[model samples]
Target: MQPSGILETALYVTDVEAAAQFYGGLLGLEVILRAGDESVFFRCGSGVLILFNANKLKDRPKGGLPIPSHGATGPGHVCFSATRDEIASWKSHLEVHGVAIESEFDWPNGAHSLYFRDPSGNSIEFAEPKLWNLQ
Candidate 1:
């Protein structure tokens, strides 16, 4: 298996620009790619956040927002790893935005994590994984 690792996470949003502002302005992500009225990609460490124009999908005759089928099947969450200090800051940042904290944990090695969701209800987290490989 070629575990090259995940490259990005695509999430649906009502407003792409607003999502960018929340993620980029407040969360310190950098917009790496943006095609007006289509999609915008934000950089978070080695990963990317892909946000699409919600209305554009609606304007199309064939495709609307993607929903789970008969049961939860495919994509679920997009986690961003952060340093210990960064995790603390992220916890406060999300709190200030009135974002609900779904959970928090202190790992065995003392690394920490906080889970929450975006405006579109996609579950996301800022974590400090104790065992991450550079390779």
Candidate 2:
């Protein structure tokens, strides 16, 4: 058997609070959980987005099974699926909140996407669902 779908995606951020404000406040994602200053979790349509404090997790003691503590330094990326109409609305909403739109792409298949950075500089994208389907 093979994996059916992605359940969660994570990004390393320096400040959990600022990440929360950007994901929850600006994007309207629901803050599902917060692990003190270490991490924050947001519910994103059928999946979970985890914002982790890289510095904090880097020093945590290892537990059984040798599970690696995941963290990153440079910008991470996560893309969310939206409808064409929703993509347009998102552009307007982001502008209203003063979030800069870094760039936008129109795929040859006619799908479009908007790219922007979060508080910790993780590249976030919202693209039309059709962008991911096999042409």
Candidate 3:
């Protein structure tokens, strides 16, 4: 059997509050939940974006649900689907907010993509669905 699709995407950050500001305040994602300074969850389209402070995982409160500890160190990458128009808008919005655009280009398939880094240095991308031949 094959899994249907992704339901969550996780990105490790140094500070939940700063990450929250970037994802929530800048990107306009809806804040769904917050777990003290350890983690924060945001609703992104049909999926959830989870930001976790890896440094605090070892000290997380014990014995509630026995969830396995999970996190990644160093920089990670994540991409959001965007239309051409939306990408253009995003470029302007990001520049206005002082979020440097690391790279922006057209793929061989003619799809467009833009990249940037979050506060924690995680690579963030916005690309046209056509980049993957998606409709």
Q: Which has the greatest TM-score?
A: 3
Q: Would you list the rank order by lDDT, best first?
A: 3, 2, 1
TM-score of each: 0.70, 0.92, 0.95
State the RMSD for candidate 1: 5.1
Off by over 4 Å in 2: 64-66
Who wins the lDDT comparison? 3
Can you give the lDDT of residue 108 in candidate 1?
75
Model 3 CA lDDT for position 106 = 95
Residue-pair clashes per candidate, as listed?
0, 0, 0
Q: Per-prediction RMSD in angstroms?
A: 5.1, 1.9, 1.0
Candidate 1, residues 1-135: lDDT per residue as tens digits?
797867877776766777777777877788889878567898876778887766665555545556432212222477787877887888888889887899988867666778887765667877776635421
Report lDDT (Cα) of residue 107, candidate 2: 92
Better of 2 and 3 by TM-score: 3
Q: lDDT at 72 for candidate 2? A: 77
Better lDDT candidate (2, 3)? 3
Q: Summing lDDT over every window of 10 consecutive residues in candidate 3, give the lowest-scoring window.
A: 57-66
Model 1 TM-score relative to the real fold: 0.70
* Model 1 steric clash pairs: none
